[model samples]
Structure formats: C-alpha cells, structure tokens
Target chain A: MATLMDRVITSKAAVLEGSRAIAEAVRLCRPQVISAYPITPQTHVVEALAQMVADGALKAEFVNVESEHSAASVVLGASATGARVYTASSSQGIALMSEVLFNIAGLRLPVVLTCANRALSSPLNIWNDQQDSLSVRDAGWVQLYVEDNQEAVDTHLQAYAIAEDRRVLLPTMVCADGFLLTHTYEPVIVPTQEEVDAFLPPYRPQHYLTPDKPLTMGAFADPEYYMESRYLLDRALERSQAVIEDAAQRFNRAFGRHYGGLLDTLHMEGARTAVVAMGSVVATLRDVVSGLRDDGHAVGLVKVRSFRPFPKDALRSALRDVDRVLVLERALSPGGVGILAAEVRAVLQGQPRQPAVSAFVAGLGGRDIPVETLQALIARAQDEAVEQGFADLKAELVEEGDEDES
Target chain B: MKTRVEPAPELLSPGHTACRGCGLLVAARLALQAAGPRVIVANATGCLEITTSKFPQSSWNVPWIHSLFENTAAVASGVEAALKALGRQAEARVIAQAGDGGTADIGLQSLSGMLERGHDVLYICYDNEAYMNTGIQRSSLTPLGARTSTTPPGALSWGEVRTKKDMPAIAAAHGIPYVATASIAYPPDLVKKVKRALGIRGPKYLQVHSSCPLGWGHDSSLSIRVARLAVQTGLYPLYEVINGQLTNVKRLSYRSPVAAYLKPQRRFEHLFKPGGEALLAQVQALANANAAKYGFPPVTEGAEAEDSD
Candidate 1:
C-alpha cells in the first residue's frame, strides 16, 4: 500500500541561489506576516520576500524593521496574534536579536527564524561560519543547519511544520551558511503552494493573544514555578523529536526529497570509520568520504542537520556499528573547543557500542573548508587521534608578538 | 468635556497588588476605560505587570502578556502587525505599556521601531521619573537634582545630574498620528486622550505622568496632589500633537511654583536646603521655560483655581 509517507509529489525545477530558494519556500508556506531586517547574506532572503510582497505573489505584511531585534520582536508579536510569521537574519543581527530569541522560544511562540549562519565580528568578517547560531544553541530553540541550497529549501518547508506542531510549539532556527549556500547558485526544486499545503497544514496555535478570550502569556513565575516552566520546556523539546521525524517523513513523501530525521548519513555501508559534521562543512566532508570510499577506505559520513534536541537515539543507532567517529566543527567556544563536536560527544556518550570520538574544529571565520582540507585532516587523524583539536590551523597566525609597530 | 459619564466597564478589577496611592494603577484603569474590551496589552516588566499578574491570579480582564522590560513596544508592534495580517486590525487594538525607564531608556529603540513601522499600536508610557520596580533606580526621565537609589545626594553632588527625558517629544519625532502627555490627576483629560489615540489609525504615543509615592518619598495620600502639581507647575505639560501639529493644549487655570511640587517629596528635599537653593531655582526655571514654550495662559492675580477641587 502506497501510504502518504510513500507517495511523491513532483516540483518545478529552477536554478536559484540558496537565499531565493528559502524565500520561495517561505512564500509557499503562505506566511501572513514577515518581519524583515537586512544583514549581509541574509539580506537577499528578505529582499526576495519583499519583492514577492511587492509583486503580489505573496500575501503578507513585509515589515521593514529598523534592526534585527525589532524584526524578531515583530515576528514574535505577529506569531502571538496567531498569524503565521517568518523572518531571516545573520551574524550581528542574530546577536542583536538574542534577547528576543530566548523570549520567543520561552514563550513557545512558533516563529520561524531563517538564520543565515555567519561569523561574529571583532575584526569584522562577512563570511560563512556557524558561531552566531551555535552561540544561541541553549536558547531553547530548534536549531537546524542545512548542508546545501536544496536542503536549505526543503528544511525551511519542514521547519514550519515541526515548529507549529501543537506538541512542539517552539521557534525553529533554520540556519544555512552565510555566503557559501546563501550566495551560491544551484538547481533547486520549487514546490507549488498546493503541494506544500498538502504537506504542511495551516498553523493553528493553542495559545495566543486575541480579543475573544482574555489570557496572559509570558508572565514571570516565582522561583517556586520557574523550574517547573523550564522543565516543561525541556520536555517539550525532547518530545519534539517525534514530530520532527514525522514532519520530515511527510515532507519527503510529499516532495521527492529526503532530509534524514535530525541527521543524514552518506555511504554508511559496512564502514568501520565515520565522520560527523553540520552545515556546509558536511558537504565537503561527504565529498572527501566518497572519494576515499572509491579508493577502498572503510569510511562514512553522518550529517547533523538538527543541532538541538541532539537526535541521540537516531545518532546512536546510526553509529552503533562504527569503531571510530571524527567530529568536525565550524564553531569554537572561544576558551573551549568545538561547539558541535562537544555536543556530538555528549550524544554518543553511554552507548553500549560506543565509537572512539575525536573532535576537530575547522572553518572559523569562513576559512574555506574544501574537500582537500577534509582529506588532509583524515590522513592526519589516521596516525594520531585529534581529541578536541583544531583542524588545519594556521601556525603563523597564532604565534604571539609577530606584529611590528610601524 | 463629556459630563457625568460612568467609567467604561472595568477591565482591571479591584484587589490589584499596587502600593497605596500608586498613580500608575489609576492611569491603567483609565486607559482600560478608554481602550475598552477589544484590546491586547503587551505589558513590559514593571510594577504594573508584576502587581497585576502574579502567579495564578491576573488582575487584567483583557488579553495581556508581560514580556521583558525592554520589548513591550516591539511585542505590541508584532501584535498590531499580526492583526493587520489576520484581517482584524481594526476590530482589535494593540497597546504597549511600559514604565519611564523602560520607555525612555532601555526600551527607547523598540519604541522608536514600533512608531517608525507605524503598526497601528497605542503605546502608553507610565512615567514615574524613576525605576520603581527595581527599588527606585534613577531613570532618564528622572528630573535633574532628584534623588534615587542610583542617584543619591552626596557631599559634592545634587542627585540625578540629567534632566527629565522629553519622551513625548521623542515619540512625536516619529511623526506618528498622535503623541500626547497626560497626567493621572486629570482622569477625564487623560482618559479622553487615550480614547482619542485609540480612535486614530497608525502609531499613537501617550506618556502619562504617574506619581510613585514610595519612589518620590511622599505621603501615599499626596499621590494625586503630586500628579496634579506636576502639570499645574508646568513640569509636566498636558498637550496633544495630532499628525505633528500642536492640536490641543490644556491651558493652566492656575500655575503653581515648582517649590509646591518639590517640597513635599524627599527625593527633592535636598533642593530646599540653603546650599541647594540654586538647584531649586533651576527646576523652577525649567517649569517657566515649559510655560513660555507652550504659551500657557497666565492666571489673574486674585483668581481662585478653577481646578482646585
């Protein structure tokens, strides 16, 4: 029997950059209000939506806010009114909206934030990195990182469904790399509104601010109840795994694309060694893994799409047979080590058939993580285990007192 | 002025946990009367939210949400934008209320964003001149030479060095449909302005001068008197700007000296001492400047105050 999970819906294939694909997917979701503010690579996503609103293609209020803080607040308010809302930002914009980010999630307002992942600044750099999004990992939001433009488009479509599910009414951060995926042009399959509608239902919220019945939301709880509220939030996020998997499966059935539940795996067949990573870096690692597999190396790739709710069971089962696991991260914890790699170790801990996990940080401030870089890292790890270490680091850059005053 | 009309059906019930003679409570009730039933209030974290909605008991009859201290305007902007998209913007109104510190300082950017976006929200700033919720810390709206927790009078200092933040003027700069300053002492005038703002379409800002008896170091019984004196002395003007034009001004029937307002509050008690006389005069000079700028009608020498009651 061809159930809904087995059926496939065809979409119109078109060439577009990652940002445009996200905009089109959001348009297909039929959001009623979009809080928009521009920052670097994320600006294109918002601009595309603005054009859609201007051209009468999307029926929504495109609020051109002054800052990312206001953008997030605008969407937070809109979502509270039970309007399906969308917003996108990157880098400092995300940091700027940090306060409201936690508020949205804590309030359990299902606001979909398309976070075009970028490097945070001191010496300002506008490039692809996961620091901005990963820094906010503990903000009680469902953070998902996409590997490519196609995955970025599909993940956005599924993000709304997973976020809006009544059982998991938390905000979702659909993160894609800044300039790499956002600016790179690729062939993306654009699903029709009818197809998207069939996959994702109209958002109906259980809690909202409206005139019909008076209710108070986002109220402060005393210490007696604060822990209870936090516990409930934690439980809801943990329970969200089922909804995310079901949504992803439904989306795959509706559209001829598959995003593995929380994490995607490549060439895992009888592999002895595996590599785990997130964001655009996963694609580079996947290419390296495939090339090494062709050379008769027993290696595989595990792409972590959802960084939050850590997909423990799925990840544990996926790597149950592997003997060694390499975890690469695009984000570092400043004084500490890799962000994603640390979480990966936490997830893989306490398993019966645990793999020897090694952490390697790469691509900070968007230093290009090409296939060659991953290939070289693999060769180095073959001889010595890279435990919570930096991969392909510049030797001269870290040497102190290297500068001469003019 | 409409005569003898009973206040609108109460959305805020009695038994709210406000301190004795909290002017913000009265202002909130009057605002509720003006805004009526079809409004969602995005209240910022302050005395109002903490007092009204505690634990399981909420004093508000209307839909209300107390988010963070510095994001009420942004939340209200969201509510209004959502209503616009939901095709119910006209039927349901959005109001963002914050205290002086929230409105004039920490929340100023959000207020600016809400107004600049023109999201059809009515934002009310309950200006108490200081942060009363967090133990009366001096705020931007804290007048010059007033004492607060953070701005104590010392050997070489005269308390808060900054003048009151002209919040209504700052809100007016956004060119919103209505920007007005009201006083809790004048309920009819204050409620009238709120209703008038509610009737307008785009963004409207109302800064209601709400006296804090605890923060101002005054007798609880003198709350109304203090609020009244703020306007009567021209320290806080009662005026409305409709679409950037000065549409209405509440001409003072009797103008009092700033001393009458400052002398009763311990926050300003320093200004009365011999060494602080100069600062007291400076405060009076500020009042005179407000009177001159607003073109307030001067009272006749022997005329009794019409508003004395």
Candidate 2:
C-alpha cells in the first residue's frame, strides 16, 4: 500500500471529458485542499476529485462545502495557510462566489480555480457561455481561457506556477467552455508526476497564516491605505504577464507542448482581416481561418488566452497592421458590445496602425456557433463596415420592439 | 512600595478599536488566553475583525486571518485542513469566530459545513444579540422584545417578535463531539470551556454570550453584569451538549427575573413600557422554558433578585 506521503503520477493519453482531464491534471499538481460545491458542468470535476480522495489516488482534503460561496471561501482560507488549494464552479456557482473571488485575489492567495464557463440564468440555461467569468473581469483574478481539453489540462499546470510565484501571488481562473469543453470527451495527454513536479515546485509562500510565524491577513484597510493595497494587487497582476510567459516556456521545456503567453495566434502574419476570440470557440475560429487561408484569403485567428492582465501590448502588436479585426466573443455587455471586443478595441486604440474593430457576440446561453455561421460571419466582416451584433442570430426570432413605439 | 505584577504575554494585544468594556473583546481575550500561543484564528468580518485588524495595525499576536463576513468557518476549515496537510495539526489549532449576525444568520451554512465535515476546529460565536458592529441591526439570534435598528419598537410592532435562534442546538445537531455555551461574565467558566473545546479532536462549538453596551443601551461598566444576568435569568443558559446529550449545566443557585436581564439594555426597554406587560410575561415564559429544559431551578417568590454566583 502506498503511504499517505507518497506522490504518484501516471501520464497517459485517454479519451476523457474536459472535467476528468482537469481533475487528472489537478491530481498531478497535488493540491493539499480541494473544496467545491456541485454545479452542473462543473460537477464532474469535483466529483472526480472526491473519488480520487476516496479511492486513495489523491492525498487531499475534499471539503464538501454546502455552497459555492463556502467552496471559494474554503480554498481561500486554505491558500492563506500556505497550502496549494483548488476549487471549481460554473455559471451561477461562479456568480455566488463573486465576492470571495475578489477577496481571494485582493488577499493575493495563490488559489487556482477552474471556471467551467456557463451562461448566467434568467431563462436558466446550463450550457456554454463565457459570461460568468467575463462578468467578474475586474475582480483581479488572472483569467486564462483554454481552447481544448489538452490546453485546459496544460493551463492548470501553468496556472499554479504563475499564481504561486512570489512576484505574482494572485489567484488564477482556468476557464474552459461549459458543455463544449467540460462535457465533451477528447483525447488529453496527462503530464507525468515527474514532469508536473519538475514544472511546478511545492508551494513555498512568503507570507501565510501559520503559528510558527504569526502574521495577519485580510486586514481592513481604511481610505488612506485601501487604494494603495489595491494598487499593489493590480501591479502584481500586471507583473504576472511576464511570469505567465515564463511558466509557459518552462512548461513547454518540461512537457514539449506550449500554450501561448497571455495571447496565442495562428497565421496573423500578413493578414488583412483576423478573428479574435477566447475559449473553445478559438479552436473553431482556427479551423475557419485555416480554410480561408488555403483559399488564398488574407485571414487569420488570434486566440486570446489571458483575458485579464488584458495582454494589451501583445494584442496591440498582433492587430497593429490588420485592416479589419473581428472580435468574436461568447459574452456581452448588454447595452454596450462584446466583452472581449471592447477590450480588443481599447488595446488597439493608440497603435501605429489601428484596425477597424468589429464586435460580434456569439454562443451565448449555449447557442451553437456552427462552422457555417463562422464562415458567414467572416465573409460579412470582410465586406461590411465596423459593426456589432449577434453573429448567428435568426433575425425572425428577435423582436424589433415595435411595442415601444405603440 | 508597589509591586509590579507580571502576566503571561497576551495572544490578543490590548491596543485596538474595540468599544470600551466590549464583551466580545473580553470573550476573545479569554478564549485566546485559553487556546494559548499555537493558534490560528479565522475571524469573520465583524467588530472583532475591524477593531483588531485596522490595516497597518493588528492586535493578534498569534497568526490571524479575517475573510469575508460569512465565510469564517469555511476559512477556518481551510486553515485546519492545511495544518493537517502539513502534519502540524498537533502543534497548531484552528479557531473560527464571528458575531451574532455572522454566526447565526449569514454564516450558518459555512459553520454547518465545517462542523459536519468534522474539521478539527473550535467554532466560536460571540452572541451580542444584534449586529452591533453594523449599527445594531437585528440578526436571527436577537432575542424577543429586543429593539434593534431594524426591529425598532413602534405602533405596528413591539420589537423583535421571534425568540433567539437556538444556535447551540443547531451545532449540537451536527453530532459534533462538543457544543458548549459560555459567557463573558464568567472568565473562569469561559476560559475553561475554550480550553476544553480545544482539547477535543473533531469540530467543537463554544458560543459565548457577549454584551454590547452601545447596542444594548447599558453603561460600559455593566457589560459583564448584563452578561452574567443573562445566564442567571436563564435567558441564555450556560451548558454543554456533548455527543448529542446534555452533559453539563451550570445550574443557577438562585435565578433573577427575565426582566432584570432585559430592563438595563436599550434593546429591551420597550418590554418594560406601559402596555408591554403581555410581552414581558412572554419573555419570562421563554426564560422559564429554558430553565425547565436545561435542568435549572424554577424561579420562586423573592428569588428574582438574587445572583447565581
């Protein structure tokens, strides 16, 4: 029998759900505390984690919190005590934990959370949408959107290294699209125990809640001091961009696979128009862009991996010379524009050659953004002026609001 | 010549922003004193957290953390889990604490989770009746006929109509090993309970009846007096429920009328007003019911003025 202290990792390629892949990767990281409440799409991840602990496959505390609020809180507390801790949630679960999300980042606890991105409820959709994580874009967590199960598994590894770095002690959210990534089965290569251990070292925190070295955490800041504390947190997140890149490089060195630093791109070179998006939809965009490039069209794809710390400089350089930038997003700002589109425009504003940024909202509330829809949207972006609207909207279904006039 | 008295170093330092004669502070000091040096406190956002940790200054000598208002128990669960993970559970102890609102109301779920999961944590609730820190708002644990900002006595209502939520019973229902009630009025008893709660292995609860002079409408000097009166009046029983059984009770030798516990506090002043006789009797009946339930003596004629101690 393997003792409690034994750390074991078995690397293999298996057809697994994104949730199972994430759980497997998390086990490789060997987090000391895993706390989560069951939410649809995000349930399988926590369930697998619970099973791992139950079966003695993982040496960790699987705290069965009553709600997602406590799930986040439990991990936050565990992280403050200098333990590598993890928790996962989706949609309303993420919304319920919104307060503690800011608390975790503000306190600079290196908690890595998996946000199985799902739509917010009114109609109560349980499928994929990036709105949940996007809504809290200003909450100070390092948000990394993964394009596939392999990337989701890989990002979890990079998330810990970036978050636990003393220079950038911020919580990280590895966002994989709900249902699309979390529920879909795909071939994922699990990193070996040796590879994970080499890539990410044991968490050695500079400041932690320990009796041996007593200190205070999460102190109440008055007006005079609160801004500066926030400033420090903001700066730490800003500084994390470099650490993200470094972790990715190191991850590639260790595992022979690399997800980009902050932002990743495909065929952006010498392209007149480019599609910029996040999450698994980026993979769909990649295929569309590849097909267009083969048909002798100047089109490319910009996969925004890091949504927070907004990758301003990388984005500026990527879209500097492009004539038209199609910002396809799964989240919207209701009255305004696509959440990622607004950021993309803001990032490219002062560049030497600014692109005409067009906002396109897609895949909201688990709505499908099929390959034909992407082709149609790309053709429209190439032909039309800079615009913002639902890319795949059935015009007949949307009311023109003649009632207001009546 | 004056001889200087040397005391053990305080785990909770004296300098902070707690109200003068604040019973929560007193309870915190006693609990920390009992738990000794090797402890980590996960305090919920309340008077204790605000007063002790005002950014650049902190009153906690031991490792302390203050998360959000309703997640202290969950945070303590994490701290305890981490300690266990590090194999330092023997050396370090975890304590989670919150005020009445943070404990009995908003924080109940997390506290239940911590207790149900059997984390080796000592969860303490400093029940000061109302949300004293937030301008005396009513919490679920606020007693009947008490006037908080939210439950002010008026033509439409007398005050808080509901009885105090039995939080200790709720904790005991989790099948935890120990669930005890203590009071800031009795230092020896409070400290003993804290120490005993810490000595146990699994989750233990110690709810300390703390007074808020500002919120309760009493002089700061009467904080301890009011707290003691609560126990003596049987409005707040000092007892322990261990392993689902009523194991210990600090039986009152002589009891006071519930009015004695109520009249001094501004919160319960409405109960003593004209046309408040029926409500007063109801309050007294609740206290009598507590005495009956906790194995304390029923009040007799002329016994209403005597002290328990």
lDDT of 2 by residue, B228-301 (tens): 88988888888888888887798888778887788788788888789899999999999899888887787754
DockQ of 2: 0.76
Taking all chains together, the TM-score of candidate 1 against the true structure is 0.95
Give candidate 1's root-mean-square deviation (CA, Å).
3.5
State what share of the real interface contacts each candidate retains. 0.77, 0.82
Q: Against the hidden reference, what TM-scores do the models get? A: 0.95, 0.95
Q: Which candidate leads in lDDT?
A: 2
Distance (Å) between predicted and true CA of A160, model 1?
0.9
Please tell me how candidate 2 rates in CAPRI terms. medium
After superposition, candidate 1 runs with Cα above 4 Å error: A1-11, A400-406, B297-309
What is candidate 2's lDDT per residue for A1-406, written digit by digit as tens? Answer: 1001111233567889989999999999999999999999899998999999999999998888899999999999888988899999999999999999999989989999999999999879999999999998999999999999999999999999999998998999999998899999988888789989988889998898878899999889999999999999889988999999898888877877776888888888888998999989877887788899999989978888998888998888878778998888798788886688888888877777877887788889999898988888788778764557676666566675322110
